[model samples]
Target: MKTSRYILITLLMIGCISSCSDDFIEVANKETLTDSSFWQTEDHALQALTATYGALHGADGSKWTFFEEIYVAMAYRADDQINNTAETYGRNLASFSNTTEDSGPNNIWKTSYAGISRANQILEKVPNIEALSQETKDVIVAEAKFLRAYYYFWLVTGFENVPLVTTFEVELQNLFPEQSESSVIWSQIEKDLTEAEANLLTEHAAEWKGRATKGAAKALLGKVYLFQEKWPQAEVKFSEVVAMDYALLDNYADNFNGNSENGPESIFEVQFSGDRSNGNDERQVFNFEISPYAFGGWELFFPSKWLVDEMKTDVDANGDPSERVYESIFFDDPKSDMYSMEATAKIPYSDVAENLNNPNYFKKYSFNTDEEFYNGTNITLIRFADVLLMYAEALNENGKTPEAIIEVNKVRERGNAVPLTTMTQTELRNQIRHHERPVELAMEFGIRWFDLYRWQRGSTATESIKSTLEAHNKPFSENFQDKHIIFPIPLQEININDKLQQNPGW
Candidate 1:
């Protein structure tokens, strides 16, 4: 029902906003702007652009949740790693382990397409502007193009084939181009990112602190290269970003704090604000991670035991798990036995009473006791640390172990963990896949799955995650395949677009 209403409202808003009059006085003469008449003013163009940002915020949480569900948890489940409330999600997805079409994947397709539609509207209309500065207009167009590429990348990465739409004609409806090859979609993504990298200025860092930046485009381009095994290019692009002024935050915890949402380390983040005029901002809905039984918020997701134990391990027998625990995972009581309680009953009632006070749970992204944007911390979509890690990945894949360790060590030093002086390709690859990503990118959506795919180690890593969970007395889900990797084409799209092919084995 909520999804239905969202679509209705979006269509209505698009209609009202697209049409505008040419003359200033003529604007008053028209009954309100409708989809057919609105793109007449610079202000109108700006408002439309802002709406795209708003959609981005919504897509962050919604898309992130699905990415985590299908890519990360399902792989862990297939590996028998941890049980999930989203077990239904894993089970349903399992049926398509080798395939990709189903009802479950529909929402992501719809959401992404909606974003593309908005971007197409801007790309088509922005050029005609005699009103806005050319520079301003160029950046806006770049932003839209950047987003279009981002959305298509998501589809291509998962489904391998996706429709490529780059136009502004509602009459072109039913123009379901058959699933374009992944290579074709990637070529388009590369074009957008390259243009975006060259066009975006670093100066917009203030007004658009969390929005896309040149560094963001460069970093994304590098990631796309890494995905395609274009190692040298990926290495060069990531190196370029690393050379830029961005650096990792001194404290890993600060990156997640509400006040520091756009910290120096964040290359790009989804800008979620608390200043919603009509309804609650879903972006500010931080309660999803908090324990629902104790607090009013729902503890809908929790860190997998595989994730927790791996971080908790003494990688070098350094006597302690380094200082990263405080930032990566939350412990309700710093004094409690984090590895030992037999059950919830084993937990002292005193601890239960002080549950809200307990700090043992993951608290890196916690809200302060009082703040207007309590749940509104901007979620970092890409950060310098991620860039560093991806750089390390490209270097390692290219068989440059020493250079890769340098990248890994840079991130480890921040955690106070000992860094490897050297490692083999296998060791570096394993560490990058199992340790570095989970710790560095924990709680951020889809990092795990993407890492697995890049390494082609999804099957083994899934098992490894499962084993750790089982040993720790945690539940693990099972049976993952290709369809589980991308997601089913959204049921709605399949219903509407005949040219669309369901992912194989769906």
Candidate 2:
């Protein structure tokens, strides 16, 4: 089992503070922690780092970082997802009509910074612990660097330019730091990941399975280079990761069905648990958000018709519908089953009157057998198939289209989809951008949205965004502007810090 030591320590610390007497004057009370008392032991360092990881879910328990608003902000803007609910912030984001004051962006900003703050605290204090072995301290520091880079990646990608706060001490001295250039932020992320790759273990023990690994750092660094169009550099990094002991699971659905979490395919995943005892309530709510209403889900959003149409275009080697299509969506397929029900008990999604006219509900993360809304399924951030596809993309851009097809075939082989034949770099690029990636990685993370931003035509990033949205006949196509490429800095943040500036058209 993944360790719950971190969560238990947090609860114990909270209990310590709560139990302190109101009658007594507070002056370095031993029961209640101060900086002098804490940060003195290796256990303290572990506790602090654990809290940093916990921030991936939420700083406070109320707003789950990835499962709630952040997921909406990331996925809803893309052409693949349709927001069917009446939530104003969600609707505004989906339509590109969101402003600086939208709660989606604001909560994401807060959660990411909260994680960075905890990471910075560890970097500041973990080195000073007298009892920690140098080897252990180095690993802890490396992990902190990885986490800092992870949070900053989100900030830079979502908001373009953001404050690059590294040191807790420096942040305390100047709380209202000016935003760094996006290039500068990317450089820092590269530096952190480079160092992390050098120091992180190639694999962690079962107890530490969810922590960042060398493979995770290299994969993320590869992604950073890919975004910058550093094709050769990206290829090298992904090549190194592909050489690691990671492979696509035999069954694609096992990646999300909670049966194979922290399994061989996972490079990094945000840890969660269904057991709410010991202050561990980090389970995700994707099942509730994405499953069909007939299956007891809220039906907040459904797959766009464009995505369903795209997935259906590909066939397996047997000339049947692609297994990926059956695995990815609860469609009108007679072969597909819901809630992992038995074949005899299966119900076609089209049979339900409520879902008859709807496009399709996501089947990727909805692999539960019960009515429980929250689940312990870890949200995979990076996996081996993604690495293979990314490696293929980099190789294609680097003028190795034939070799790139090999990697793409590896992913397609696992999905039981037909492999591509030899093609030109431009042809292969279009394939990877349009067909390979969307079908393989839809409704997971922000892959589609991020791909739209990075896949440029002439000069502006919006060329790809505008063309893709228009091609899909998205309602937001008319509303999308060049400035919508990056979100506005939250108005709440700008209000608190006068030095902060919003993105141009906000």
Candidate 3:
């Protein structure tokens, strides 16, 4: 999240409190803080807390590591997307051929741990700040805890069996801690989120818009439960989120625009801004990384033909093509309702027949080439649409198909798609697994991969995963395995910590 330029300056001024340092004890100047001299003022605590918030950014350097891990490792592997012929990263992920030494996983592992280290520093120092009120201390500590849990969530889910380090004071040997059981890691996640829910405000004021909120904590906690098959607990947490003032925007695309960030629909988001007058670079390069070469960008990732065909069948409440389908995709076809902004105006993409290979680009992050340079689109982590779908899944599992359809239709109606009034329990379950989530939340992040993982956890594993893959020609017969569900622990981490073991079938 981009704070005011002053806060960003505060983050840079407070140097040497960083993950790159091994000494962690030697920075001695006023700008370089130490344990004995720092944490005495409210400003000190605030600036340190701001640094903890900085850990949430997924992009570091120019690589966009956060997107690389979630999008490449998970989303690209799923059936909904495919890499363009020129992009190796997406193709490798889709084919299950990415290695442990792959930079995507390695970067996520390093950056996430770096965030945890910063957060631990805050938790260690914030409690001792007598200058700040108890309320202020609680909120700061809660935010740090949430950040720790957030980082760990990416770790355990993406890498599983991660080092459960929770403190700053560690012996040299203790630095190479062994991997903890997935269960143990999950317990720590729940612990931090529970405390976060208790302390974070229901809503942050406009100036503090992107800070974690009660809804964010509850929603994340519920997702954790859903991952673990604790359905009743998931239902309760999602119900609380649904009860909040959050609502879907009138237009589904509003959620992706920079001018309309922190809307009622966004429960949690990574705030990005293109304004570089500030010393910090908070711009998200998602579009730059994935846009067609024609847009002066890398043609890295695009929707599969299977996905494009799925959109053609989808219809709105008005019995016309779905607004979401049109809003979500752009390809070289006049019959299909998409246009290429990079192409000449008033010219059908079909006119460019020689270049057509069903070239589909994600229109969700589309922006004007003339107006602004860098993309400022906020990446939404949780939205009301997800809460509705998760709640509907819980209802369907509990044999409340009637109630489930009502919730599912809320998302459909927002996309201007017709709502289903009737469906058997089996159909409701299929609706969630196949239709609703893929159409509404495609290419967002790990949501699709997580859906596939959890679908296999059910009794209908055969019917759920393999069938979908086969029907869509998604290379289930190519290289995916039962053990391929989770990624291998990065080889570099294994080298550093001999106590760590790789996941099965790397």
Candidate 4:
């Protein structure tokens, strides 16, 4: 959709004009827009919203946000993936040796706030635009609210007790406000999503595929409740989303390849384009970073041996490994076809020389070609399968074990895995936590890591983080502490505002 083109143009138009020639001091610059002159039209409102979406990928207009560092920060702490590169920040995060001064947390903090600031600007200015209709303004405001909640979700989950800035700030004093309690932040998220669900459209046109929808808001609200252990509320939200028009794609592989983007399975996706030749650098770098060296990729991160073993434990109706194993990772399996090979070549995993020694490389998002490059594959943030699984989890927690089994079976059937028989609530919970989620959603986003952070397996939070990582044979399990669950506030941020206090143990 050339979304990046809009972002680039809007950034230039809205950016401040800091300098002018002395000879042209009296003349007005028609090229640059001031805040007073910009918020006068519907088009300007849309442009500003586009800039907010742009901040999702590049808040500072420098690097792809989820490409490398952020991905490592979100996913590496869990056991599924391991860092293979020598980057100090990535290594520190993976090993639990990070400090408040580390760049990984700082980058995430800055990028999320950048998005929040843009969203706040829209919430403050768009409603007053004289040229916009009330309906249009409602939709735009709903989207801004959703984006703000999405950004804050990352902040509160990743960095607990962060400052809550709902309004756009111009004054220096307002910019450096004190951090709010996590409970307060959660209330704001729920409020935003509830309003968003009421106002957002059920679906968007094909041209506007990645914008937030009513179903997306409901699903995210369900997730928020799930994280908070509010089982009844989470179940209600998820049940509403289940009633919406969405389903699992028949071919599980369709979820990852660029072929069926924004299809029935997607609730929301981060839109990316492969056509950088047009000066629109919106391509995603997941494939480039995770593919094996044989495919001309950097091999920055790959599936851990433990995850490969876990995927092999499940078998389909035909008494073979589940189809998800072959589809999700490239391991040394004779039955699995190597996606990087030519279609007619019939290359299997065992035949690839690179597969002989490596544990496994991520195959879900890798381009099915030998050449290494960025791709336009839209990263699905919330999909139907995930919602179904989460619903199952919530249902189980709320004493609906049999009903929850129905939901979990729906996802398992799609993956060609055997369905579960009746089991106790505790047994089913373990199955969902240890096997179903890790196998189904590994290496996608920080799902695994976030799951670990929220779960309390032992007597305390510290025990949960340590035991889970230790069970997975993570190298840094021994280094985990209570403070390791949520990252310390960035030292640079604290230095800028004395009101900010670092998280304990930093």
Q: What is the C-alpha lDDT profile of model 4 across 1-506, one tens digit per residue?
A: 33463373333234455547766546456767778778889878988888787666656654455666666688888888878846443788888888888777787898889888888889989989989999999999999999899989999999979999998877667878899999999999999999998999998777777888999999999999988988899999999999999999888888898877888998888777765675657677776677666655667877887888899887898778888777888877778764542332435776676544366787887765233355678888889999999999999999999999999999989989999999999889989988899898888788888888778522212237788788888877798887888889998899999999889888
Question: Lowest-lDDT window of 10 residues in candidate 4?
Answer: 456-465
311, model 2: CA deviation in Å? 0.5
Whichever of 1 and 4 has more lDDT, that candidate is 4
TM-score for each model: 0.80, 0.92, 0.89, 0.93
TM-score result, candidate 1: 0.80
Better of 1 and 3 by TM-score: 3
Residue 294 local lDDT, model 2? 67
* Candidate 1 local Cα displacement, residue 5, angstroms: 20
Off by over 4 Å in 2: 1-28, 61-65, 87-89, 170-173, 278-280, 340-346, 353-357, 369-374, 457-463
**Clashes per candidate, residues 3 or more apart or on different chains:** 30, 0, 0, 0
Report per-prediction Cα RMSD to one decimal: 6.5, 3.8, 4.8, 3.0
lDDT of the candidates, in the order given: 0.62, 0.80, 0.74, 0.81
Error of 4 at 309 (Å): 1.2
Candidate with best TM-score: 4
lDDT, model 3: 0.74
Sorted on lDDT, highest at the top, how do the candidates line up? 4, 2, 3, 1
Question: Tens digit of lDDT per residue, candidate 3, span 1-506?
Answer: 46332142122223344556675555456645455676789878777766666655543433255565545765777777776656666566677777777766777787788778778888888888889899989988888888899888988787778889899745577789888998899999999999989999888777778888889899899888877777788888998999889998998878775656888898888766665664556567666665555555566777777777777667865566687887777765454433234643323446654554437777677654233436567788888899899988887776678988999999988888888878888888877877788888888876887788777764542355555676888854367766667778889889888999889887
CA displacement after TM-score superposition, residue 59 of candidate 4 (Å): 1.1
Residue 172 C-alpha lDDT in model 2: 42
Clashing pairs in 2: none
